[model samples]
Target: MTDAMTLDSYLAAGGVLTNPTNVPPRYRAELMKLMATFVDSELAGAAGFADVINQGPGIKERIAAAKIVLEKTDHADRVLKIMGEFGADTDRYATHHPWTARLDRKADIGATRSEHDMRLAVFNYPISGWTDAVVMNLLMSRAVAEQLAEFSTVSYQPLAEAFRQIAPIEAHHGELALEGAVKLVENGASQDMQDAVDYWWPRVAVSFGRDDPNRFEHLRSLGLRHSTNAALRERWARSADEALKQLGLKSPS
Candidate 1:
């Protein structure tokens, strides 16, 4: 904020950089990676869900599913435009990979990513059916909410502002998923719903990634991250468990 402030000191003192030109080279690289990861995950998530709109049990369910697909893709676009400010080939980046492509349902790749994209590891697995899709959406939405909460506070003003505007919309997607799950339970799929929860919990948990203190410190110095991965994962666990309990569904072991 002061005229003589260095970027590091400014960020450490809670200053925000409003433009791409204001960012240093290393900060720019990390910010690009962060944006790319989010964009890839959103595109992949939307693509996976696009296939399930017809699998919805009713018109309302189908409408919710379609809206989610639309909004998530929109969210990706908003961030990708930011990436474009850094000279990334936005057109090529969008079409560079098959976003809809997924691994076999039984793939056990853990948090390892496929060769071509940076979508979270959890997205690599295919959605099995309506129930499975609902569960994945609900759980992943909570994780996304936590991530957005953190991202919304980073030192990059424009990207942080983008996430701030995005957090509420993403939260609504989680709410829609929760509502859909409750409908499934009321319609006599409670047990089946629990099974879906069990299937997705671990995969979603791993998407939080492993904690590396060194890496966290490095990123923190750049003002790109405030909390460690372990902390965020634990926070999401509690949030997910509480959400599951309200629906009378037990959290996975």
Candidate 2:
């Protein structure tokens, strides 16, 4: 939300970096630049969803979602630009992000598939938000934002600084999604609520990352990541429990 940086010209607000020992001075700019690219790519990916492009539950919802996605994309671009100013490379990296792979699988396609096909293919039958995508957006997007909130404070100065600015934007995005989830449950039958919880619970547990050395632990040690995946998963479990119970759904035992 910095001047000349408020999504107007796609620029991120700059901040002072006092922690130089933990994060490399050279990597600071580069990290932010890469972070921007990631966020921009993330927004673009969200837009590509079939549910996002097509009309969903209503016009107002569709428009609102579109605007949010655009703002996210623009915000990422702004941060990416600022990172460049600090000397971060904008090179894109291939992500071995497991969650994305799971979603893209034929059997586990995202939330927009037709009811019959989704039920037939997806192990989880009803992906709570496939109808509006906002359901999926809310659950999945918020997860990403929650992690990034801590990641923004990573020891890497450039990325940490960029994250400080970007976190609020993503937080807004995450809240919008949660609101949509609330709307979904507003008139949702008891069964529907259960179905939503059932669909998300398993995936949530497995959401952390693959069992590879190239994971959060390594990143944390390098000062690229701030928390361990195991720790994060524990935190995620605690966060999800209350929400599950709120809908009369049982958390994983």
Candidate 3:
């Protein structure tokens, strides 16, 4: 059989590619893009959160925010190492863009990426303060959970394993956000929390990206994607809505 056919059959049968040398050109391109998106998002996320660490209400809250910032940067490094194997300039990649830069909070960019990097559009909005940061973190972390779950099973063995290890750490970040939100609600910040949620919900929702069946199927054939964007977004919406309801906050209509 041809090498392409062999690779196709292998991927179709749930095989995993362990290294960059064996990856086909098209698959390599797609995989690099995937890794770049993940790394860029993590770096930007960490940078953004770092600014809010001092704004956390208490020592514990500040510590949690600091840990998130540290771990997110580490996560970006982990994936960037994988990209490095594919000839990406790991050093230059992390430093070339302004990771801490953000658009005005009221700007509406939808899911479109910024010109300089592949970080998700949601990361382009600034956190208003402690409460707003917590709301954005909680909502966005849930989205990250969904995305990580999908990524953990990718056909690239090394990248998939990296995601598997990173998933629990990211989930812990979500738990911290949940704890912070609950405390804020108990401390009479329920309305503020709701307003932040209203502001962040649609922005976070758009991070799941648009629903395109053809693109999804193409990724699926390469074992780079498993679920449709709409399905993943709907799942995140249900979970996020329930989380808000627990804090006595309603999702924006």
Name the best candidate (by lDDT): 3
Candidate 1: stretches off by over 4 Å:
1-5
How close to the true structure is residue 118 of candidate 2, measured as C-alpha lDDT? 15
Residue 46 in model 2: shift from native, Å? 1.8
What are the root-mean-square deviations of the candidates from the true structure over C-alphas?
2.1, 10.5, 0.9
Give candidate 2 regions above 4 Å deviation: 1-37, 48-50, 82-132, 189-193, 210-218, 251-253
1 or 2, which is superior by lDDT? 1
Clashing pairs in 2: 10-78, 28-158, 29-88, 30-88, 111-130
Task: Name the lDDT value of residue 149 in candidate 1.
Answer: 89
lDDT digits (tens) for residues 99-211 of candidate 1: 98998887888899868888999889899899989989989999999999899998888899999999999999999999998898889888888988888999999998998
- Say which prediction, candidate 2 or candidate 3, comes out ahead on TM-score: 3
Cα-based TM-score, every candidate: 0.96, 0.60, 0.98
lDDT of 3 by residue, 30-149 (tens): 999999999999999999999989999899999999999999999999999999999988878878999999998789999999898999999898989999999999999999999999
Error of 3 at 26 (Å): 0.4
* Pairs that collide, model 3: none
User: lDDT (CA) for every model shown?
Assistant: 0.90, 0.51, 0.93
Q: Which of the two candidates, 1 or 3, achieves a greater lDDT against the reference?
A: 3
